[model samples]
Target: MAKTLLRSVGLFGAGMIAATLAPAIGAVDVGTYKELDQFMSVFERVRADYVDKVDDRTLIKGAIDGMLASLDPHSAYLDARDRQNMRTQTQGSYGGLGLSVTMEDGAVKIMTSQEDTPAAKAGLKTGDYITHLDGKLLYGGSLDEAVDQMRGKPGTRISLTVVRPGRDKPFDVSLTREVIQLKPVKWEVKNEVGIININTFVNSNTGDSVRAAIAGVQKSLGHDPLGYVIDLRSNPGGLLDQAIDVADIFLDRGEIVSQRGREKGDIERRYATATPTDLAHGLPIIVLVDAGSASAAEIVAGALQDQKRALVMGERSFGKGSVQTVLELSDDTALKLTTARYYTPSGRSVQEGGIKPDIIVPQLSDADYKARPRLREADLRRHLINEAKVDDKILEDDGKPDPRFQLTADGLKKQGIDDFQLDYAIKTIARMSQPPLRTALAGAKRGAK
Candidate 1:
């Protein structure tokens, strides 16, 4: 019988595995060897006696995936396709809908859709679910597979069945794919204030772009702007080095961020470059964040807040403080491992408890902002624990209705304010730039008297 043969092979393979590993490890721990032996037994049994033939590569890849999946949600084995996708994303151009997504309960959930992308244009909001692609069910499939199906030749059309919370029934959205060219940093002058929107940190030229944005703002005004608003809302993070560079641009001195590995002494610290010129020239800055701001985005926000260089505004960020190091295993394969937990300059990790804003400015312009459920690092399966043990009570109470955020979407629209958060930030900057009315009128009053 197949069962009898499988049992015999499993016992034989266990002994063989112990004998093979003993010589290499030199007195292998009994417990570890037993576990490895059990693994080998299953592997051998599957290879020799499975109902249908299975390739070694498939089996090995599955094992590697299983191993990484046990560690954390972020760690994974990147195949050739995955590696290519990673490179494309970092380079800032890809053929897709330009959506940041995550797998939750075997369904692909939308994290955030990039501005001006097909997904964003299609009215796909954050926290929406893609239940089907092109009328085919996508649930119960791998995230990678769903992503691959979504990405194709530019101008290709794809239909998505979206299941959004608060909606009674699912809706279909038809989108034509295009090259999603991510502008890492976008700048504009509003009310004589420099508005620097950092959409992503994945691009290599993100730091340079920020510098250029400041220069552009100055050129437009023919003078230094009142202040700057660094908008980092819905910014999923990218490169660590890029984050350090961007933070250094504004900071003259002090630590930017520090990452700690497994060992106590295995720590690396990054500091801002000592420069004579402050890019903003000590101007009042407001770093705006929301639930969608993450990783490198948090790095920039955290550094500015900790150094007292900028007032962090808006909602708390997406707390993904762990650092991932990609180790290439082969020409086409690599291991993306969670190597360290990064801390802000003040030695606070934004793991589950993200960077709390000095001014909690909610996005009142969004009608569904209150009704929609937010997904964060704490919501992920097998997420790394914050050593400080984040207070659940604080997290639960964060969304409690504040009397300060009184503006509603319809009310804001009536006032011609489309983006409440950005408008609030710009207004704050404008107020900081002007001198006190009492001081300005003091001379006039004295002369009149």
Candidate 2:
């Protein structure tokens, strides 16, 4: 049965909801109604007294965004463009210049550009601000509007006016749009172990892709892979269902993840069931993640760690543990509402505290890893607070380097080594694959002489 959910406010919904939910539906109320009236009055004044005329659509959308922003970082209004982009991401292919961006300080800031995509090829770095798209100014406009302008048919060109930090002046770069197709799971045999790099959980067939990758790796190596390294570094997550499905691909049976919604009986749990071919066949698995691993990425990592199905390595995940349900509105618009908190099988929420790796391996080969501060849920404005007490280190900006990882990126580069975290994981897997000191020692070593 369909249930009533929290309503968004354009007409002072907080007070309106309070009225309907109060013990006396029609009870005597003064402060509540008066406050709502005051809000509407101000809203009207803004429409009337603003320096320039603003359309009702812009005003209403702004109000909606403000309302959602006040709640949490994930809750958002998806305009027609935003809705289509969300669909494109989850469905895997689209005609566009692939990249993720967000509104920051009145400009559109680039997040990590997807690998092999035009954005990455165009040398767009994280935090680079796009002031204009196709020569049209994006400042003083909605982020959704900017995103709409970036997507188009293959072979179409979009010129981006970029304002990169450390550069004296802004510059423009033209990129041809292409059909952005993500090979979500890419695998290779390294050190006799299969290393599967899951770029994203955006694609619907990510689980199948993983299975195929593993099987192909084993076939190419002419022997069973020593184990598997599931690389999730810098992977901004996508669909929740895909995360669950990917987690289940390796497990024989266990609860992958669960979500606790706002109301009772809203709890949903997903379990890892037997697949048609458990091709991996009880091999040791190591999952690698970093601060960029979030949402769906955390789900897979957390579930595997909790179930003891895989050893989670590398830094803690990005800690985006909230679930956003897209509620469709009129005219292709939607609402990305944060409705629940995701929990691992052990009932641990990956909120402000992300999934801590069983073996923490910092990326010592990436020169920029230390220079750039990692952002987590704790850093987000109006993020959902975790009820459990957390250590200051989780939220602290201790710029000091770790003694455990003393390898210099320059030295590693000279030695022809890159991706120190993956290198460490591969070495660890090699050690584990070595035959035990003895099948039983065969027998204890006798004292010499």
Q: Mind giving the per-residue lDDT tens digits that candidate 2 earns over 354-393?
A: 8888888877776656555566778777899886756747
Q: Per-residue alpha-carbon lDDT of model 1 for 115-160, expressed as tens digits?
A: 8899988878889999999999987999889998998888999999
Q: After superposition, which runs of candidate 2 have C-alpha atoms over 4 Å from their true positions? A: 1-32, 121-141, 145-178, 263-266, 274-278, 394-404, 437-449
Model 2 lDDT-worst window of ten: 440-449
Give the top-scoring candidate (TM-score): 1
TM-score to native of every candidate shown: 0.90, 0.81
lDDT for residue 400 in candidate 1, whole number 0-100: 60
**Over all chains combined, what TM-score does candidate 2 have?**
0.81
Off by over 4 Å in 1: 1-28, 396-401, 436-449
Report the Cα lDDT for residue 345, model 1. 92
> All models: lDDT?
0.86, 0.78
Instruction: Please give the lDDT score at residue 58 for candidate 2.
Output: 78
